[model samples]
Target: MDRIKEKMNQLRLEAEEASTKVEELQAKVKNLELENLTKEQEITSLSHKNSLLEAEVEKLEETVKTLKESAAEGQAHGTQNETLNRRLQLLEEEAEQADKTLRETNEKLRQTDIKAGHFERKVSALEAERDQWETKYEDMAKKYAAVQKELEEFQMEIGNI
Candidate 1:
């Protein structure tokens, strides 16, 4: 009957809405997960750079120690002392540059952590939304099944008539 057809149409519409909601939630989750992954990679890269900077700092300190020792022994000498002083100044500059790079890398890592936290929260929220969509879709599916059964019975009755 016309009434059964209208009921079927409404049920289908509700089901479609639920389906769309689920799809949207899934997309949000996917995008957030990708962003989180990128943040993790950046963090890893920053950590590696930190290690390299630490190593450079250690090497510079060793060179400075050796230069000071040579300067003490060469107090009687002048020409090589000038060369050692110049090399020491260059090493000091390299140390300062390395320290600056290390600080910048740390700052970047901190910012990345904050962004990653935000992404994690968003992903969690989207997962909750996905669960909500799943519940709604389940409810709509049940309603649709009931409507289908009722429509089928009605059709049978009309046929019999």
Candidate 2:
């Protein structure tokens, strides 16, 4: 019947649309995953830099202690002690700046992880929608086939009469 054919066409179109939407969502999820990976790599690099800065700060602190001991024994000049103090101050400042940068990088990585989780949820929902559409399409196809068979059987009966 014309009505049955029309219904089949509509269901087919809806199924195709659902499939396309699922594909688009999957692509978006892949892109978000890649972005998360990039952010993780950046965090790793920043952590390494922070560790190196910490080691430098420790070395400078040791040097300052040795200089203080020399000054107590009156072996080191006053000017040299002042210069070492200034250098230690600068190194401490650099270490603080590095620590701040590391914290900011960690925050960014956390945000990226959140975004990736959101996209993953969306993909899962879309996939479920697509599966429902496929099931509906299959049910419609079977009904159409049954209707066509009924029409043929009625035609054969009329011809015999």
Candidate 3:
């Protein structure tokens, strides 16, 4: 009977040890679940922040595209302005030649007055021609100035753009 009691006591001790091990395992499992829940919440917050950053990046890209388009338009305008300036230069050269021709014609008329019998008539016609040339020259000069002013304003606008 003593030996049987000793055997029963050993069985009881083994059962107690098994129960304690089970409790430790259950506590460890509960702690792991808590840690997993905390990690999941952090991941959700990080995902939301990542989406917001992506939206901002998209907006910045659109702005860059608009700026590039504006630069291209400005370059086109600059080329057109250069062409206009070249035309104005040609017009200026023509005006200068017209003035020189008028001067030469007036000198010829003065010499004709000294030698020709119909000097008065010749002088009057030559003066009229000179007056017309002067009017046309002045008009061309005014137009050139206006065009130059316009070109300057266009250049300023391109810079601003």
Candidate 4:
């Protein structure tokens, strides 16, 4: 009976440890989810900025084309044309940089998504383990109760003798 009680205590301790681990894992999962959300928001913002930059580049291209046509019609607009060309080149460079940044952001998001999935799986496994531990603890508790009842009955019989 003492051995059974000791085993029950051990099992209870194990169950509590498992429960603590599960809680820690759940907290980690929540933190990862929040980080995932933040990355997604950043990706969205980058995409919007890229689109705006592309639109601006298109307008600049149109203006450059018009200026070139005027210059061909004998307009002394060489200086203005050169300035516009330089501005257009700078805009194109800016657009390329933005595109590169967007691509990098997308890759980061993909990696983060993968990490989140891994954590989710880990959390699920931990939760399952915790459930098993809880079941074991309940079984131990029942056995301990039965043992105590038997002890009580034995004591009563001895007293009657």
Best by TM-score: 3
For model 2, give the 10-residue run with minimal summed lDDT. Answer: 71-80
Ranking by TM-score: 3, 1, 4, 2
**Model 3: per-residue lDDT, tens digit, 1-161?**
89988889988888888888888888988898988888899889899999998999899899899989989989999998999999999999999999999999999987886768576778889999999999999998999999998999999999899
lDDT of 4 by residue, 3-97 (tens): 99999999999989999988999999999999999999999999999999999999999999998887786455776788899999999999999
| Candidate 2 lDDT, 81-151, residue by residue in tens | 88899999999999999999999999999999999999899999999999999999889889888988988
Q: All candidates' TM-scores?
A: 0.50, 0.40, 0.55, 0.46
> For model 1, how many clashes?
0
Model 1: residue 112 alpha-carbon error in angstroms: 0.5
Error of 4 at 63 (Å): 30
Clashes of each: 0, 0, 0, 0
Q: What is the lDDT of residue 99 in candidate 2?
A: 93
Whichever of 2 and 4 has more TM-score, that candidate is 4
Q: By lDDT, is 2 or 4 better? A: 4
**Which sections of candidate 2 miss by over 4 Å?**
75-161
Candidate 1 weakest ten by summed lDDT: 72-81
